[model samples]
Target chain A: MEIKENKKDAVLLLELKGRLDASTSPKFQKKILSVIEGGEKNLVIDFSDLDYISSAGLRVLLLGAKKLQSVDGKIVLACLADHVKEVFDIAGFSVIFPFYDATEDAIKSFE
Target chain B: MHPSELIETNLYREKERTLFYGFIWSAVFLLPKTVAVVLSNSVVLLADLLKSISKCIASLASWLSIRRVAKGKDFSYNFGYGKLENLTSLVLAGVLIISLLVIGYEVYHRFLHPEHIHDFGVWFGLLIVAAKFVIDVYFWHHDRHLAKIDNSPIMVSHWKFYRADAIANGVVILSLIISVVFKNISGIKYVDPIGSIIIAGFLLSSAYGIVSKSLYDLLDGTLEESLQLVILRELAAFFDDYKEFHGIRSRRSGSHLFIDIFLEFDNEKKMGEIYQTIEKIRRRIEKSIPGSNVTITPTRIPFV
Candidate 1:
């Protein structure tokens, strides 16, 4: 998991490159939480390079979204491949969350 | 000690510590044992060489177990990965027991047909004793510190094995001394094999004890006596406002606790009060059990 902060738009880009299964989800959560703590209100989780996600990964993402919401912060998913999107839909996460096709669109909507 | 602190802990740190220690010990004991066996044609040296290999395997297993145990909770394993530690402990025990049996069989064969041992066996046995003594003492001191601060029972069990290894090496030195001192005492050469079988039997028992306790914890066995009492006291105090409390059920998973209670509150009371009561009980349990992850289910008492 690679996390990069872009100060230009106050956007924190998280690049998840590998499988986020039960073994690795906690680490993913910790990294995201740190970004949240740094006052990055606009979070762009780039899944373009991500391969797989288990339920544990989904739960961590949900927790992240909930935390950001409490602070009036916005979290958006960018570049969702078809299979990954299916997981979100099956879990009814699609109803609870806002998603976008590209990073530019999610960032623009945040403004 | 603090829930917030536990929540913030990096599950990777302690795991790395376990792996580092296991790897260090494996390299230290295994390298010399293998080299000694080749340099000196000694049966006792060969036996100790086998023991070193077994120790290395146990250490490797401990490393893998540490990684698994450190994982946090998820939908796949709702309770968390703590029980993975217990599973690993059981597996380690099984492996040790199997090694002990194989070693014990060889010892029995050696005893049945006694033979002369190489002179180099004496020098190698002495060096092993010196090395084991230093390592054993170091492990003992560090293990006490780790045991006090960490909740890792498996690590402590491994430390215990190290202590036993030191003792076995001491016995090896004794047998070597007796064999070298007097020609008539060559009869005592049988002691080495006899002692190994005895040591193997002891290792089997210790491993069995560790495996059983780990399995018990994994199965949601009873809590420590003092902790159980504290839970019951808190429950009784929380529900005192109700008419009576019955059928209080509780089970423990790693650090998480789940409790269910049947309450006979006044049927005349408002629903809001019942909700408040349940909420209060939930908070109380959480407070009582430090680092507790709790879920409480309330059942209304049936009217007669």
Candidate 2:
């Protein structure tokens, strides 16, 4: 999977492309950890272009959420494809994360 | 021992009792099934006989392993004898494979020499198998309940084990009914062998589930994906207590969950206060993940 990063003021918006599966989750994890460690608290992950996400992908989201929550910040998701949203709901991740209809909404929610 | 410890120990004892009784039950049913096979040329009964034999060995091994663990066989080991249950399950998977092979042979052999399955023993074995089915249903439900309470791998394995047996028993009963009642119908000779092949298919599926699951846990793999998320969620909820998240290590031993987390706390905090924080985190994680033993360490160094 490819992660395109763009910062909007204090919010860190990441546009995910391709698939987030077992093979790609490790890189995603490292990126999340480093960004969170860099003191960037607000995380906006846009899943519009991402086609698939397995359980491995969910684990990384959790780790990122944990770090962000510890700092009184949050990770919000946006533009999730129908199937990817179904995956989140089925995995019981919908309650743990805040989802938005657009990237602007996700970043604005942090503001 | 403490009351909670005593309760946990009793749960394990109950687990052992369930498996021991199941072993005896499987052993007792073996004879009539075998006799039924010998009394008739029905390949389905032969396949069931093989399944009964396999169930006997599997349950016996399962019981023995739990018995060993309960009897303090883990004094020499650090993590205890929990993985022994997984090892035993892997062995039982092998037994299922053997049963499948025997069924394959019987099915192949019968296809070559078509024989009518209606005889004095064909209808006779039906009663024994029907009784066995009822008993299997009981154990199947019972094992699930026990496994949920104790989270023992043997109970989980036997639950699936009995489910497969019960389902195959259902198939065998149906095949026998067709064999006896439809014996006058032309081309009825193939039904008995077809039933044998179907039993082999169930055995194959059960073996795959057992072998894959047992091998993964026996190798000290991490917690499953959902469970891993559960830990992170708990940690996230208690995020403010610790200064830094160093690392987390977790694995499954049979049905037991072992999780260790490393965190950095402020050095200025009193020892008692830091311990209270750790205890709270540990308690929450353990509560979220049932049958888990969680340890939180205060350290700057990352530990996996």
Candidate 3:
């Protein structure tokens, strides 16, 4: 799995490409938390290119969302591929996380 | 590829194919029919023209709804754009109603002051009827096949519209034949306008169908009783997992189902056990109702 990070106007955009499974979830969790630790509050994860995600990936997302909630910060998702969206739907993450169809839309929400 | 992925791919391809065909029919076939209407000044031709126009508008609305559904949920519209399909249906119904009023008015005027239709063009009318018959048959088969696979309301609606239009065209043809056969019969002049009224009536009924269904969806109507029963039966299997469960709400948005389960777990159970039980119940519900988003909330207070 590959992760791309960009900072735009204090919003940290993390774009994930490739499979997100048990093998790669820890790294994903570490990268996201590091950003949060670095004092970034508004986060948008782009999953337009992500092909697959397992329960491990979902755990990391829930942890990140929960952590952000504690600090009055927010994390939203954007451009999730159909398969990944289905997983989110099946796991009921849709109720917990806010999702946008575009990264720009997600960023706009923070404003 | 997974079966779900394969099905998604098929649906995408079919949508594109159907939209392309619609565009071809609108530009090539409908434009000529509009010209024929201008030439004939016949009530039956006007009804045929209006039917084609409604079909074109309906096709465009269906495509827009499909695109909106793909866009998914955003921060502003957290529940997703599934309702856009219903909204489109509502708007289409309104348009059909307006068209029906206009056609009804014209029919009424013609009944009071019957005018001879100049350049009736029986051959042209026959050609259009034949063409419409072919198009209707093709779309009926195509839409029905896709509807069976996808179970989309929009697809079913399209098939219904096409079937209705074909029958309307047959009525128009019969009216034209009556005018041609009984040219000397004064009563025969009413046939064309009467045919227009009949077509308007069909449109009115279809518009009513669309309006009622869309309104029901907009109001967040619950899923069909049979589907809700399936979910309830699945939840019954996990009776021992939770002390009590209530407020099991379920609604549908397009093809997606949203379920909220409120349960009072046994206080003696550990956190992990409670989580596992919730997950089990959710999975069971989802297994019974595919594409269901199940949210289980643990309530501290048990319902009386």
Candidate 4:
């Protein structure tokens, strides 16, 4: 998977591409963890090009969400594919992660 | 919202309306039919009355199941109430089988000792049959049209009931005509019993079909071969991503498919990268088979 990071003030916007599975989640997780360690609070993951996500990927997101919660930080998801949204729904992750239709909305929410 | 989702919502509302109307119509007609059976002393009419009763029960059960399923998953029921449809089907099948046996026994007894017609009100029987025919035809057409679009098992089952009732009404009318026309024939008395047997046979076969289908679902049967092929094709495309992958298991619940796969990736690869690869494969599988819940487990060694 490909992840492009854009820093907007205190928020970190990540545009992801390709698949987020067992093989790619570790890299994605490390990237997010490093950003969190750098004291970035608000996170927005843009799933406009993301085609898939499995349980392993979900776990990474959950971990990130929990980590952010500990530091009074927040993570929002945007532009999810229908199937990917369904996965979040089935796994009951929708309640844990707030979803926005666009990255701008996600960034605005962090304010 | 997508157009398809809007259409689906409309269709679901329409289905609920149709089922509610059908249940009300069946109950409204059931009382008079039961009275007719008591007054006419016709085995065919009695069988028809039993069938109507069973249909009403099945309709109510199906409606209840649909309502329960609509409530979605709860703390008590994690998988939702989709299985209620299968459970209702099983109960309906059991009722049908029992009704079939009762009708069959009545037919057999009538063959041994035929009784003289006391109050064989042909006009009364015809009136009840005609009313039933109208109701069955209306619901049958409506249910069939909806079933074609939704293809829900409960809707299909309701359609079967209506179709069988319409056919059974025709048989009852035919038996009535034969008994009335050939009043002098010694075997004319067997017409109604023979009609009951035919109706019983129809019920038995339909019940068998329902029982087998519901039982298969209850047992957690695998998805259709075509769907399994789609999953396999998706997996085949990602063969190089992992060193070895096995233990692909799948089952269907309602309209959703649940898939479990185990993969052994290169040991040197980072965990996040491994997750990304698995996610890609999951996306491919989900695209090929929509509305599937997938679980991917990473293993160090292949299971022997």
Candidate 5:
């Protein structure tokens, strides 16, 4: 999976491409956690190009959400493909993350 | 008890019905086969008699165990009566082993002596066995279906038993055909003993299969990895509602799963909201995994 990282206003945006599964989740975890450790608080993960997510990928997302919750910062998700959204819905992870129709809406939530 | 607390599983009733059919079916043939063994000196008839009697006993044990488990879910047994099914299967496995020894001795004797005498009563008994073989196939297929839906130890054990019984009936039929019809062939009489040995082999294999599976279920621990991930997914989805991850404890009783997840809620979170959150988490997990009960406990200390 390719993770494109940049800042949009005060929000740190990570747009992921390819499948975020057991094979790719660890690398995704490293980058996402490191971004948090680098002191970027408000985060948005764009799943527009992401195709699938297994339970392992879900674990990392939880870990990232928990770490952000420890600080007063937050993480929301954005631009999920239809199939990818279904997975989050089935896992009940949809309720845990603020989901947006577009990356701009997710970044706007922080502002 | 509330209706919601009851497990909606066919894990007991389906297996009970399967065993009941087996019991009644074997009971149908038991007397005639016994008579055949008494009247004939044929090794094949003696093997058939042993198999018929053991089927009656094995089916009765399995049937009674399922009946007990089906109706005996009481507060005294915290995890319900699932383990009773395993114990009874172990008992039936013992029956198979004993029958194996008896058949082995009879076949060995026949190997040394090569007795060829047979009576019409034995022929009539062989006809009954052929009918019972059809019933064996029915139960084999029926138990196989139930085992697929309810992968409980009892159902699986019964499925294996019926499958072996069906094939063994076929072997017994082959031996009867050889002794009753092909006795004039030069070396045909010995095939009767060999057929009994083959039937004994099936019984041994079935016994081994049941013992290994029942023992494993008896010793199984914790929820599997995929199930654990499911619990984690729900927790992650509702991450804001609670504090620390703490831990999850889970185990299976019969076909039911019991899971307890430990989480710390914010001190100031209202009692009503915490209750709602707990209900939401519990309901989602239970919905995702059928025949499962999930409890979310709010606490300050971590408990796994």
Candidate 6:
């Protein structure tokens, strides 16, 4: 998994791609943990190109969200592919992490 | 994180099933031989059969121990069940030693009574020893292959058991050969019991080694000094900016290593860069420590 980070308007935009299973989830977790510990405050995860995710992947997201919340920051998932979106919905993660259709909307919400 | 808490992976279910099959085969080979010896009322054959029966039980225990040891860390076991594997090794060693002692005592009784054994009893004992030798060799090779690929202590112990079985069988064959060579010698009948005593001594020493080592690990003794120095040096070398360290602790269960260290860095380092440094160090430490769980903590200390 590759995390491409961009900063604009005091919000961090992270592009995520590839399958997030047990083998790859740790890398994703480390990336997200680094982002949270870096004090980015607002995190916008763009999942437009992500293909699949397992329950372990979901645990990483939850772990990241908890870390972000500890610092009074918010984690938003944007551009969820339909299948990824379904997984989030099924897991009730959509209720825990606010989702947006585009990175621009998530950034605007942060503002 | 506690050492056991970091154990996230385990052997697959297929491996567990294979161990079960191996244990069953071992028992199958021992039962008929044991029954034959008891029916014939031959002390030599009876004692050998009893030893095989104990080996069968220890084999079953080995299977159970592997299953239990491969389990992930639970709330009751903060560091995982790796120690269970060590305990199993000790249990196996203890069982082998106890069997040897019992057989030794029986052999001593036979030495006092001096009874003549039938030719069929001798032939049956020889056949069983030959069969057991072949099986033990097969198991040893299989266990060695698995241990090479997986680095499992349980597999290593199993391999050692096979080696020990081969030695015991060789003793049996040697004693039989001696009886044939000295058929006219009046005092030659005591060779089998004397061989039993020697084999018992061999088992006692090996058991002491296994039990002592496992007990030390169960008590959380420091790992090999060289391994500790190598890990510490690897961390320092991988992260050049890390000037000092403290709270370095490590313990090993089976082949897996659990390492905890507090890495000192310059106080003014940005948290992001610091985290990146720590991440890199964690990766390097893991690479250096095979099958390792590494936790690196960033701490600020004066440059010295």
Model 4 local distance difference test score = 0.78
For each candidate in turn, the TM-score is: 0.60, 0.89, 0.65, 0.62, 0.65, 0.64
- Tens digits of per-residue lDDT for model 1 on B88-202? 6777787777777777777767877876555675677668657876786677666655544544556657667677776767766776666656536647667656656656655
TM-score of the candidate numbered 2? 0.89
Superposition error at B133 for model 4 (Å): 3.2
Q: So what's the TM-score on candidate 3?
A: 0.65
Candidate 6, residues B20-129, lDDT tens digits: the string is: 76678677877667755654445555556655666677678878876676565457886657777788878878787778778877888988986555556666677877
Top model by DockQ, which number?
2
TM-score of chain A of each: 0.90, 0.98, 0.96, 0.97, 0.95, 0.94
Arrange candidates by TM-score, descending: 2, 3, 5, 6, 4, 1
Model 4: residues >4 Å from true position, as ranges?
A1-111, B1-14, B116-120, B144-151, B236-243, B263-304
Q: Write the per-residue lDDT of candidate 3 for residues B1-304, one digit (tens) a residue.
A: 9998677757856865786576468556777787677766788788778777777887887786786666544578756476776777787787788788779878888989997665456657767777877887788788877766665667767777777877887888788777777778878778889889889888988888888877876788767655655654554455446654444566766656788777776678898999998898888887877667899999864222
lDDT of 3 by residue, A1-63 (tens): 999999989799999999998689879988977998899899999998898887657757755
C-alpha RMSD by candidate, in order: 18.8, 3.0, 18.5, 16.7, 7.4, 17.6
Which run of 10 residues does model 5 chain B get worst, by summed lDDT? B2-11
Q: What level of docking quality does candidate 6 show? A: incorrect
* CAPRI category for model 5: incorrect
Judged by lDDT against the true structure, how good is candidate 2? 0.85
Model 5 misplacement above 4 A: A1-111, B1-18, B39-45, B117-122, B144-152, B178-186, B223-243, B265-269
Q: Judged by TM-score relative to the true structure, which candidate is superior, 1 or 2? A: 2
Clashes counted in candidate 4 amount to 26
TM-score of chain B of 2: 0.96
A13, model 3: CA deviation in Å?
63
Q: Residue B58 lDDT in model 6? A: 69
How much of the real interface does each model capture, measured as fnat? Answer: 0.00, 0.03, 0.00, 0.00, 0.31, 0.00
Candidate 3, position B207, lDDT: 89
- The TM-score that candidate 6 achieves is 0.64
**Tens digits of per-residue lDDT for model 5 on A1-111?**
899998877889898999988689879988977998999889999888888887668767876777688788888998888887877776678777899998888888887
- Report residue B166 deviation for candidate 1 (angstroms): 3.6
Per-residue lDDT tens digits for candidate 5, residues B1-304, read 5554443434465567778888998898888777777776667667767877877898898788778877787789977487777788789889888988998888878778877757575577678778878888888788888777665676777777777878887887777776778778787778878888888888889889888867766675666657766887778767777865655677777766789877778878899998999999899999878768788888777452
